[model samples]
Target: MESYASSSARPDRAEPCPRSAVSHGVGLAGLAGLALWTVLAWRYGMDGPHAGIFASVVACGVPMLLWSLLVDRVHRRPSTGIDWSGPRRSAREGFDISVVKLAGLWATWGAIALFYGTARWYWDGGYSYAMQLFGWAVVPLLLASIPYVIWLDRYLIEPRDGAYAFGQWVIGGAAGKPPEGAIGDHLRAWGVKAFFLAFMLSITPANFANVIGWRTGDPLAGPVELANFLITILFMIDVSFATIGYMLTCKPLDAHIRSANPHMAGWIAALICYPPFVLMGNGGPLDYHRGTAEWDMWFAGNAAMLWIWGGLLVLLTAVYAWATVAFGLRFSNLTHRGIITHGPYRWTRHPAYLSKNLFWWLSVMPFLSTTGNWVDVVRNCTLLGITSAIYYWRARTEEQHLSEDPDYRAYHAWMERRGVVTRALAALTRWSGRGSPAAHPERG
Candidate 1:
């Protein structure tokens, strides 16, 4: 008999089937439940503080249970190449495979569901009790499908000749020989993980406190207060996702550490915008509060204007969150975990960075400073400009690294030719006698 992994001999190789109707139904049900929960919460208020937490569990658990039942049924059947039934089969042989696959699926899904559900609860200001419940119930169930997904890939979906075991990948095991890398590469990975871990810790709880304030009827009497609230929530989600993606996942999801920013300039430019460093040296001007009073004064007594500005701020923050969500479990800074082309990425190459900078420009009103001094105004604007420029540089460096992969190269070309922002940028550069922006090697 031909090996399962061999593509040359067998014409009709076994493959894992596509998601079942039951799975689709479960997903739809989850969405509908979320919508209903949102409407009800908005109308009558939540079931109390822990309502979202409860909803999150159900949302994640039910779908998982349903999907597992399906997988168990399918696996029990005697499929052509993946038959578990045999005249000489021993009870231990069946037990090992079944237990390992199920256990792996449960563990992975449980972690994902809990983290995301908690994040959602905080984001909704604990008022979206029903939505939180949906998150709790649905996310885990969705994630629980992974182990069976691997099983299908190995036994039914792909040619299994050299396939790695489903159990191995679940526990962060690699299939082949360990990748060779210099000590610096390992150090960089550790550093990157540590930085994001600290970033999350610093922001998550602080933002959650802000959410609680919002929920408890704290006075958001002005546009600045509302904008700050929304901004804090957005950063909380971003930092949480980044922290989990970098620190919690199995080895397979980890970005292959090709290289770190060897240039001192890169480190200085990026780190200065974050904590500790942001508190030191010329970084004071980069602080978001440097112009907040001016912004508040400009919108004073103009409720309509405040509302419009606040709405724009929220929209920009939503875009940033959309990009983060698109990354799922792969989000992190200064690292490549394959080029994502979905969500906000479909419209622009740097949606998160663009949205974030725009938000700061509006919220900070860098053109106006508290001191009313020309020098302070100039310094604030310049610092913000430099921050924006730094992010642009980060985007360029990321593209340069990702271009080494074929998928990223194709994505780059497609974005250059068709993406709204890149296309407009190329045209502007051409109009300015700079030639096409795509002419730059890194642009591709």
Candidate 2:
């Protein structure tokens, strides 16, 4: 081992990165688990069968849980609402809390099930897979909730949360009703999970299958093929991490939803980007891909241009996926589990949104129509612009929600002052002798 004369003598430690809520260690733990699983799949000639695809949840979740609990000691955080030092709730009180929580939770699950059963789209295409997964999971989840809720309520700082309030309303009527907005809050939080979780699950199997069965043809035969394949891998990583996040939103992991977005605008902004409601989908109002050809097609026969363009597309996707990875097990939409200030987040508040929008613009090149019709070109470009505007709307509403948290506000300030993109733009403005307009703060 080598010794340093002083702290200043060590270049490696010269500048410490800004602290992030989710530690690099925890993210690495999840990545390591995922990497190991990938290695095993490749070694064993796996094709991402149903079992193998579902196993990804375990592959990513277990290691993250272990690291967060054993190493980071995340359970000790005040945000978790757990008080290990204090005596637990009384058996009777705990039972009461658990009972109400169970009532609320089971009712919520039932409602979600009813909604799924009635929704024609949920029964169609990829969503059918999510419905199947949820069907397979229901019994296990119902059986586990009883003991889990009881055990958790014993240590929660205050267990009479929205769920408990809803439960009270369900059983005790108006005489023992909770606050005015408690049930609404409970619904919004669960709604976020229910809507997004199903979508994540729906995409996960296909991505996993694509990645594990990535041996089709020579991927490197062309830049576009390689890029598509690589994008599949990045998407797999994003889906795997996001699936773990939605499933592991537990108090024990200190990743429970502290608050869901309260604004209808915020919910609307996010929900429209997802399935069954997405306006940007094929033939929807914002279907920009209608007249656009693939990026590879535009640069066909030009190996150099295709390679460069494909590489940029891949980079944008990597950033988008990195934004998810940075969340560790806290990557839910419309909820503030915690504020993260590292990884791609350090560069921008909404790296995923930014990069995804950029990817759509570059990859689709909406202005370039397959039919070479200026009319189609204008329509596609305009629609894609509106789609991007929706994302911007989402970012703003999310910022409005998270701005209430001091931690998020601090991160927002740091990004405004020291973010890589901010600094670069500042330099460019100065070089061009132009005054830079003030940019609004954002949240990750």
Candidate 3:
């Protein structure tokens, strides 16, 4: 939320963003659904199988979808590009269009399948789990796409979106040409979905299993253990919502991607943070955990310090998860589905990144080596610094992408004027007699 300074105190305060497309209420609905599901699963010890974990997603998604449709009326939004009042085209006339659309859609899936097959990483490590998921989903998806395309085609104002355009190109004809760069845009969007969805699915099972399987006589016995347990639950929430996001990018719920990030830097910066490409993985270049112990280790005998530090870390982790919760079902990297200004987003634009980096620093003190080696300290700290720099780059590129949208520009302007971090930075900038930084921005 922007500052609430009255006119008497402040002369120039900008207006808030025009709309927060994702409602705070909708996120609460999802949270409610997930909480109910968590209770039942915990009671039954339904934590052994990945399938039950997948079902937890349904707990959240079903309610969110119902709330979005019945309460928020999201499907009626003009942004959805659906015109419910339009007269239907004759079945014969619409049949060809639907066929072409399905063709394009299937072709896109085929290309993704080929890529999955060719990519050695997909068959190995965590990605192998994602492949297993794809195996189960492909058939149902193929069958479902047929009716989905035909039904949606009837309402779309211009149904010949990226899939239709790409399909035309694949089929080869003059009709396939959809202005310039349309096909490129289509491919870029799919590329984003393919890459990130796998990563999300790949980790969901493991993380969900960990959270549900966490059994202890009293996990709350110690402050540090209680904090850890709570943080794990938060991460579980983040994972479930994020997976729901990648899965629900469709118009019916008004959560379709308006555009994927067109910038290469955005893609590279995001991809490097996950899976086989992750630079911070074990033995990777940015592995900063080489000679460090948990932050609590330093305060082992000091109960007060341990509790204080643990509470701080848990708070940061909650902030990180709250950022994901704000996204509801539209969260994804390298894509702009819509502008969101609720939940943790009210304080700063990048709550997840800020809180996440803070948690890492406080939790690992990676610079303080257990071996008392200066080289380890410098290497670890420098590497972690670079990791943060990459997040900064990722943030700038996201802002650059979202800048194309006037609403986001308005939101950015509002943040510059009233956001806690942005306003503070501006004051510091003016105090130092240098203007606020450009292309470099901060969020909660």
lDDT of each: 0.50, 0.80, 0.79
lDDT by residue (tens digit), candidate 3, 1-444? 222111112324355444788988777888898888777777778775465445446988888888899999999999999988873675665677888778888999999999999999889876888898789989999999888888888888878888888888878775556657778888888888898888777777776676677776556788878888888889888888888888899998899989988888888888899877899888998999998889878889899998999999989999888988888878888898999876666667787888888898999998788999999999999999989888877787788899888888877766565555555655676799877443242211
- For model 1, residues 1-444, the per-residue Cα lDDT tens digits are 000001111112243221211223333333344345434543555544443322322432233334424543423432223433332334454344445454444554455446545653334532243334445656665566554444433333222211123333444433332224433343454455545544554344444344444653443666667776777656645544444455432222222333454444555556766655663234375554554364457787898897788889889998887666555444666655545665556566677877888987887787876777777788778877877776777666656656666766665555544444444555677789856466343411
Give candidate 1's error at residue 110 in angstroms. 28
Candidate 3: what lDDT? 0.79
Candidate 2: clashing pairs of residues: none
TM-score of each model, paired residue for residue: 0.58, 0.90, 0.93
Cα-based lDDT at residue 124, candidate 2: 82
- Candidate 2 — what's its lDDT? 0.80
Full ranking by lDDT:
2, 3, 1
Per TM-score, what order, best first? 3, 2, 1
> 1 or 2, which is superior by lDDT?
2
lDDT by residue for model 2 over 1-444, one digit each (tens)?
000001111123344434687987777888788878876776676654463455457888788889899999998988888898864779898897788888888988899999889888888877888898889899999998898888888888888888898888777854386889989989988888888888887777777777777675758777888999899888888888998888888888889888899988998998888878889999888889987898888999999998999999999999998989888999999999898867766656787888999999999999899897999999999999999888878888888899999887766665555455555565666788777634555442
